[model samples]
Structures are given as C-alpha cells and as structure tokens.
Target chain A: MLCFINGEIKNINEGSIGLKDLALQRGYGVFDYARTFNRKLFHFEDHLERFRRSAKELRLDLNYTNAQITENAETLLKGSDLKNPALRLILTGGYIYSPSGNFNPNFIMIAEELPTYPEENYTHGVKLLTYEYQRELPHVKSINYLNDIRLDPLRREKNVFDILYYFQNGITECPRNNFFVFINDVLITPKDFLLHGVTRKVVLEMANKYWKVEERKLELAELNSADEAFITSTTKSIMPVTVIDDKKIGNGTVGMKTQKLIKLFNDYVLQFSR
Target chain B: MLCFINGEIKNINEGSIGLKDLALQRGYGVFDYARTFNRKLFHFEDHLERFRRSAKELRLDLNYTNAQITENAETLLKGSDLKNPALRLILTGGYIYSPSGNFNPNFIMIAEELPTYPEENYTHGVKLLTYEYQRELPHVKSINYLNDIRLDPLRREKNVFDILYYFQNGITECPRNNFFVFINDVLITPKDFLLHGVTRKVVLEMANKYWKVEERKLELAELNSADEAFITSTTKSIMPVTVIDDKKIGNGTVGMKTQKLIKLFNDYVLQFSR
Candidate 1:
C-alpha cells in the first residue's frame, strides 16, 4: 500500500511519524475512510466533514486547512497505482495538551486495492455475536477503539468476522460498522449508540427515498425479532446479517429489502461525487 | 526522552512510527506509565502486570516478554539525561490483527523524563469541571482516546487543566486521576466508575490501615457534604480537593487526612518497590 504522511507519499514498508503526534503517544486521534468509484471519490466531502467534526470534538487542532486535506487526499489517490482504491484518512495528536492549541497534525492518507467481498458473505450472510461493551463517545468519531479492540480477540476466537455491541439498553454497533434491523417493514436503528455512520447515513437517505425509517432507542427485544438485519460502513457497504448470537435472521439469508437498499445505496454513492 | 521502536533506541525528538502500528492507523493500543524513585521504578511490576491486563482486555498481544520490556525500559531510562524522570510506556497495533488465542504481537515501550508538574497549582488547588464522556474500556487502557480528546477542547476553552467525568449515576474520575472524598471522618470514593489507579490503590491501602474506609457507589450528595476530598494518580501523587463543582471541600484547603495520606503515599511507593 502507498501512504501519505504530512503531504509526502511513502511506501508502507518505510516508517513514518515524528515525536509530536500523541495519537501515537496517548492514542489521541481522529480519522475517516471512504472509497472511490468510476474515477470519482464517493462521499469525500461527507467523510471529510465528519473527520473535521471529530477533530473539533477531540480539540486536536489541525493546522492544515480543509482545502489542503482534500487536495492532499486527491493528490495521493492520483499518485497511487490503484484504479478502484479504498482510501483511508488519518489525523493524530499534535499537542493539544501543551496548554497551547498549536499542533502539527499528522495527516496520513493511504490507498490500497479495493477488497472483493465474497458475494455470499453478503448474500448467504455472516453470523455476528453481541458484545457487552458500548462506545464511550458515540456521537463523535474519535480514534480511541479499545472497546472494539478488546472484543476483537473474542470475535476471532469465535470465528466471527464482526461484533454487535449491546449497551445496557439496546444494540449499538459493530466494532467498525453501524447496525440496522428491519422491524415490520419499518427499518429501525439504535440512535445515539453509534457514530451515525456515513454509510448508515446513506442508508437512511435511501430509506427516506424508498422506505419508512425510524431512528430511536432500539431495544434488544426489537432486534431479536426483526424481520431482517444488516450492517453498513464505508468499506463493507451493506452486508446482510444472518445470525446474531446464533439466532437466524430473515429466513437465514439476505432479505429483499436489504438487496433493494443496496441498489439504492450504490446509486446514492455513485452520484454523490459525480 | 528516549523511546524504543522496532527494537532501536531513538530520541523523542526523532520519534517516528511504522505504518503497521495501528495505534496510528486505527487507534489499537494499551499502555501504562509508572515512575522511578532513586533510579528504581516504583511499582514497576504492578505497572507491567496492569499493562498486560490492559492488553489482554483489549486483546492486543504483546509479543515481547515482561522481562524484555523491563530491559528496554531500563535501557531507555538510562539513556535519558533526566534522573528524576516520569516514565512513558506505549503499545500499539502491529501490522496484522491476530485473533487466535496466540498472536505474536508488535508493541513498543519508552521511558521519558518526568515533565515538571506546576507544584504551585496543586498547592493553590486546581479547578476541574465535569465531562459528558467516560472511558468505555476503562480496564484495557486502549489507544482510542476520543472522549478525552473532545473534553480537552472544552477544557481549553474554559481554561481548565483537568476534566472530571460523571456518568449518569454520579462522579467518576478526572481525565487522568482517581478521586477520594472524606465525609464525616469516613474516607470514601466512587466505585466501578473510576479507574482503579495505582496511587489511589496505595492511598486506599494506607487509609484502610490507619482510618475508616468505605468503597461503594458515591453520589454527588456525599461529595457535596464531604468534610474533605482529594484525588490520586502517578503524576499527582495525592492532592487534596479544596473545591469541587464550585463548593468548598473541607476547609477549602488541603484536608488533614489528605496531608497524612500524602506523607504515607511516598513511603508506600518507596517501601513497596524494593
């Protein structure tokens, strides 16, 4: 993979960073990722906006202007050999703790070959297990991921690819993906228990365009009996969830609504930047 | 400051990282910092034990042995010019995410000169405010620090150093310290809602040995009516809480028990270490 650190392109094999990025020190970071389609970056503006919001929430001052980050991302994408690349953007600590707001923010953009999701993984579906932990700061997209990292081992042990997190009240999200369930033809999702994912947002927009959607506090009971279920993320796109906690969902396969929403989502992203 | 990464000693001024260290890429990390007294690390073993626990909780495997980490820490400490230094230990994501029960880990550790804490601020007492966010994986000490990062910006805008956090129940902890309150000669603290800090642990041991101690959920009511209050941490050691949420704690100065605990805490660290 090719990576960009502070405006310079470097091979992932080479080490990068300076002493100042506390994201390396204290895990202070804010990042976002998206993919490109048809020679155009999908939801670049939306992702960057979220990235900026995350930085604002974390108080990590980025000296690089928004225009600069966007330009750099585009430049790095062009510099890479990837035609249909998955793009990642990362910003780390630059001294917000120094009593002065000055920070030399670490901006890294990496481009890699797009992943080919096994069609069945989304069609026949993947099984998921629920975790006991919840995101501490779900409203802002911050970089501290210990909650998810802590569960990754268990997921691996269980041979599950992802996790469904249940807080005291309801289901929140997957480690990196936002969760959704089809409840009686009305799509329902747990509100405020997740990062308000960009892809989830796209799904919501599509829902508004084609289906009834409800964003509220979702109870575990609702999820246990949902007609269908799926997860959304920039990378995963939309993948149907077949089993949660060993329970079959939606005839043990991807549902019709999910497939329809996937088409709507693709249309949304393809037209978003172009 | 001296740091070791990829098995080499490097100055903090030249601190850099590899792309694989997801502490930068994805904020996957676990770390702990313990101090040195007279060239010997205080609670070094405890710190390592907790570090391992933190990693285990986060499911990040540390490929290195405790003995190896200790040796690296010692080497880094010896290279640093500052004799009375505060140590910094960090572990980040390796190139691969291993999920099996056994995954060879990639992590790093560094020891740095203890930065000077403004002693006068503690003497005069510092002002702290409550934050909405709390640590999700309070046990593992992961690299994802978005909550702390977000609270920091507001703290900066308010010009405060520490951000006290309170969950829905009551007060939890400051961003980097644990809390204590003395009410009606009964020393007490918030339970489960705060990090079980080393200094806090030492204080509790000393208090149980010499005074009335209570460990349970603490409501804001108890703090408001407290006779005295204080906080503990490796950095702060022990500092009395003269004021909390604009209310005077005890005589609005260091409490008598706080004074006693402070004296005992130093001896505890020294005696416990050797």
Candidate 2:
C-alpha cells in the first residue's frame, strides 16, 4: 500500500517516523480516519474540518492546507488498488526540544483496506461492554487510545464488539463511534464529552426529518428504558447495539427504528458517493 | 548516539518505527526514563520495575526480561561517549491487527544527552500554573502527553516552568513529575490518581526520617497555606516550586526543607554512582 509521509509518496513499509517525533516520543498527535466508497471519499470535507480542528486544538503546525491534504489523499487513493481504501491522516508535534522552540510538524497519510466487521454485527445488531471511564480532552480526535486498546483482551474474552464509556452515571461514547439511543419515540444522543462524529451529524440531520431528535446529557439509567440503540462511525456507518454488558437492549434484537436509520444512512452515503 | 531497537544496536537517526506501530497509530505504548550520574545509571532497577508495571498495565507484551533490558542499556551507554546520558525505554504494542493476535512487541531504548534546565530555575525556584485536569490511567506511564504538550504555548506565554494538574479541587501531579507540598511543616503529596514516581518513592522514604510524611489527597486550596512546594522527577530530581498560578509559595523562595531534601538526594545519587 502507498502512504504519504512528509510530502513524499512511498510504500507503507518505507513510511517510518523518527523516534524523536512527538507522536512516538510523547504521543502528541491528532488523527482522523475516513473511508472511500467506489473510489470516492465519503464526507471528506467534514473529516478534514474535524482534522483541522483537532490539530489546532493541539497547537500542531499543520503546514498543509485542507485543499493540499485533499489533493495528496486523492493521489494516495488513486495510487492504491484497494477496493475501499481507508485514509488515516496524522499530524504530529515535531522533533525539537522546547527551549529552542522550533517545531517542524510531520504529516502522514496512510491508505489501507477499509476494515470490515462481521456482517451479522449490522444485520442482527452488536453487543457492547459498559466501562466507567472518561477520556481526557474528549473533544479532540487525538491519537490516544491507550485505555481503549488495553481492554482488547477483556473485550475479546467477553465477545463484545466495543466498549461504551460512561462517566459519573452519564453515558458518553464508544472508543471509535458516537452512540445514540431511541427513547419513547425520541432519537437522542449525548451532547458533550465525545468527538462529534461526521456520521452522527448526518444521522441527526436525516433523523430530524423523520423522528424527534434530542441531543442532551444522556444518563446511564436511561439505557434500560431505551427502545433502540445504535452507534455511528465512518467505518461502521450505523450499527445497531442490541446488548450492553450482557443486558438486552430493546428485546436483544435489532430494532425497527435502528434499521430504518441504517437504511437512511446507506442511502445518504450512496448519494454522496455519486 | 546509538539506540537499542528490538535486539540490535544502531544509530539514533536510523531508529525508526513503522507507521502501523501502535505507539504512533493509537498511542498504545508506555515508557520510562532514567538518567546517569558520573557515567553510572542511578536507581535503574526502580525505573525498570516501574516500566514493567506500566507495560503490564497497558497489556503491552514486553518480550525482554529486566536483566536483558538492563544489559542492552549498558551496551548502549557503553557505545555512546555522552556524559550523563538519559535512557528512554519505550515498549510499543507492535504493528499487527488484533484479530490474528500475533503481537510482536517492539522494545526501544534510546540514549541521548541528558536534558538540562536553566541553572537559575533551581536556584531561584520555579513557578507552575494550575490547570483543572486529570490524567487517564494515571498509574501507567503511557505515551499520552497530548494535554501537556498542548499547553506549551500557554506555559511559554505565562513563563511558568510546568503545569500543576488538579481534579475537582484535589491536586494530582505535574505532567512529567510528582508534586509535593509542605503544609504547616508536614510533608504531603497526593496518594492516588497519579504516577508513583521512583523518585517520589525514594523521597518519601528519605523524608520519613527528617519530617512527618503524609501520603494522602492534597487539596488545591491547601497550596495557599503551604510553607513550601517542590516537584520530583528523573531529570529535575528535587527542584523547588515556589509559585503556583502566580501565588507565592511561602516567601516565594526555595524553602529550607526543600534545600535540605535536595542535598540529601544529591548525596544519595553520588553514593549510588560510586
């Protein structure tokens, strides 16, 4: 696979970062991932906007403009032969010490095959484990998934898809996805302490036309009364969450409303791809 | 300078990790740093123990044993001519997808010139700004310093040495050091929700002989009544903190007790190096 590293396109194996790069030294970097459909980048502008925001929040000197990054990503996607390429853009704090104050940021873009989950995860709904934790700097899409990746073994042992993080009795989000629940015929999601996912934004816009949408602080206790629940991400789109911590959500099956939203999101993606 | 990567020793510039390595990809890595005194590693066993704990906390498979890592560090230090070298040991989660579960961990040891702070910082004592934040997995020394690095501009603008993190009115720690304060002539530091630094452990042991040491939750409001304050780390050792958020600590000078502790720690280091 071809990857873009500091203005050069090369093989992914040859795309190595120096040990001094803060991305490795201090994990001081921000990244955003988006997927392509039929060789077309899906919601590239929104992803780019978030990427720029994340970089600015970290004070990373993202020298390249959005247009330049988009062009480079296009070049990378065109150079790759993957059916559905997933583009990961990383902006790192540069390799200089603080006193000198000269930071030359390293920008990296990797084109890889879009990872696919089990089809049953979307068809019959997936299960998630509940974890009582909150991410630091929740708004920025920084490359800090230490807590999330550390639970891989427990997640594998429990046979769950992902972990749902809740803090102080309030539900927040998953590691890589934004969570939504339907309660008493109202579509709702947590309003704060999570990355504002692009797919979640699209789902809100689409669902507002068909159902009542409420974005507010969602309580963990409210999940028991939820009529339906699902998660949204660029990779998964809309995956129904039928179980949380072995507890059944809406009869432990994919709810009708979740299926409808999935269809709507799929239609929107198809239109955007065209 | 030479660095130890996996099992081979190579030049520092040639030590590069693949883009897929989770240290860069997901910030899934842990590291511990130790410095040498008189060309001898100071308190190396304690640092290695903490490093192992951190790696286990992150579930990073550190393939090398402590003895093996120590031998490698000695080799790197012997190969380099730099006096008082700083050794940074990083254990990454490796470059492989999780499903197949074949994680070939990458252990990297980089030897560099020991970073030096301004001499006046120690003499006149340093100032720190207080920020209402808490680190995730505070016990694990993971490669997640995004928040700390992001505050570089603010710290430079305010001309403070570092940021003191407090959570819900309780003092936690500094970004890379352990915080301690002397309140009413009693030495105290936060007990929980922070990395247990090796220097902190040694300081507590030594302080017990001189002053009444209390390891409990230190409140942020207690700083106002603090007679003295200081931070401990591998690099800074026992540097005094005379001001926090522009508030004067005691008479805004390095306290007599801090100076005494500093002398004691230096003497201990001298003995260890011999």
Per-model CA lDDT versus the true structure: 0.75, 0.90
Clashing pairs in 2: none
What tens digits encode model 2's per-residue C-alpha lDDT throughout B11-52? 999999999998898998899998889888888999998898
DockQ of each: 0.56, 0.68
Worst 10 residues of 1 chain A by lDDT: A95-104
DockQ of 1: 0.56
Clashing pairs in 1: A144-B144, A144-B145, A145-B144, B85-B114, B86-B114
Off by over 4 Å in 2: A97-102, B99-102
Interface RMSD for each of the candidates:
2.4, 1.9
Docking class of 2: medium
In the range A108-187, model 1's lDDT, one tens digit per residue, is 77876766678788768888988777766677676666556666567777877788888886788887888889978889
TM-score of chain B of each: 0.89, 0.97
How big is the positional error of residue B36 in model 2, measured in Å on the Cα after superposition?
A: 0.7
